[model samples]
Target: MSDPSLVLHRIPETLVEALMMSLRKSKVEELQLRTSVLKPKSKVVVPSMRKLLTTEQSNKASKSVGRKLPVPSNQIRDIVQHHCSNKLTKGAVEAIEVSFEKFFKYLCRDVMAICLHAGKKIVTQADIELVMKRQRFIKDNKSLQILIEQNFPLEYRQLFIPVASSVTLKQRKKN
Candidate 1:
């Protein structure tokens, strides 16, 4: 964090500079989290942005803090404070919220699609894991993955599935 007092240049004097400054302020983040597990490779969407946004269920997400979004900003801020940085800025929190929302949306979409295609009304962790295999996950450490997977309490998971695979698969006969 740069000290406000170590002054080098003056504030935005022109309109263009002012707009740029405003954008920069809105995008301040200590860490750059991946927005979506399945992000578009191209910056410009071939299909209109409006159509993509509307079709992707982005409207289901809320931007305001304290709202019941898919991934709450407060929870993300807490996670960042606990694991990554203690002195993160508000902009960083907003960024996390945005990324989490996208990631969660993609996750739900993929999981639901898989379940529906399989003629199942209920979605299971197996569906989620299958989708994850096809999606692009963030660059988190293996230790972090292990920690999260095994961080469950004894009561939540009492002598059940093995660490290797949680879901039980049925065997299919091949002619």
Candidate 2:
């Protein structure tokens, strides 16, 4: 009778031999397919690397050179009219748009800085809330701070609750 150990060792050897044979067979089949004279039903054409790069660069250049305001003027006008009792002139609307853009840009810079400082590549809601909280404390504009708090009160609560829970979990683990 064959020993159990011998049977186990022979089984693995057979498996390895079978695996090698299948690999060789597949490789030979691939080579034959490559060398065959039959043409593919459809031809694929790949653009040259340089041509692709140049086109991409030109597209980016055009986009950056002729960039429009982030928010449309008409939309800003609509928002202003919806909120304000008085109708603002076109120049006032334009000024609001410009100032809004500047403020938005500044906020984005702060959020990005916070994300980087936290050793995270993607900016999460938590990062934004942290920046907003800091900004709320620092800014003297009560109206703007109140507006932010009102608009995202629930979001801020949801983000912070999870963070507090995580801290408690870590403390428990330590204990």
Q: Which one is best on TM-score?
A: 1
Off by over 4 Å in 1: 1-67, 136-175
Candidate 1 local lDDT, residue 97: 73
Model 1: per-residue Cα lDDT over 1-175, one tens digit each: 7876544434423554667665555554211223233453524222211322453366354343354465456656765666564688877877777778787887888888899899999887667666766674422344324545454333222333354233312222221
| Candidate 2 residue spans exceeding 4 A from truth | 1-67, 137-175
Q: For model 2, what is the C-alpha lDDT against the true structure?
A: 0.66
TM-score on alpha carbons, each prediction: 0.42, 0.40
CA lDDT of each candidate?
0.55, 0.66
Error of 1 at 166 (Å): 18
lDDT of 2 at 118: 83
Candidate 1, TM-score vs. the true structure? 0.42
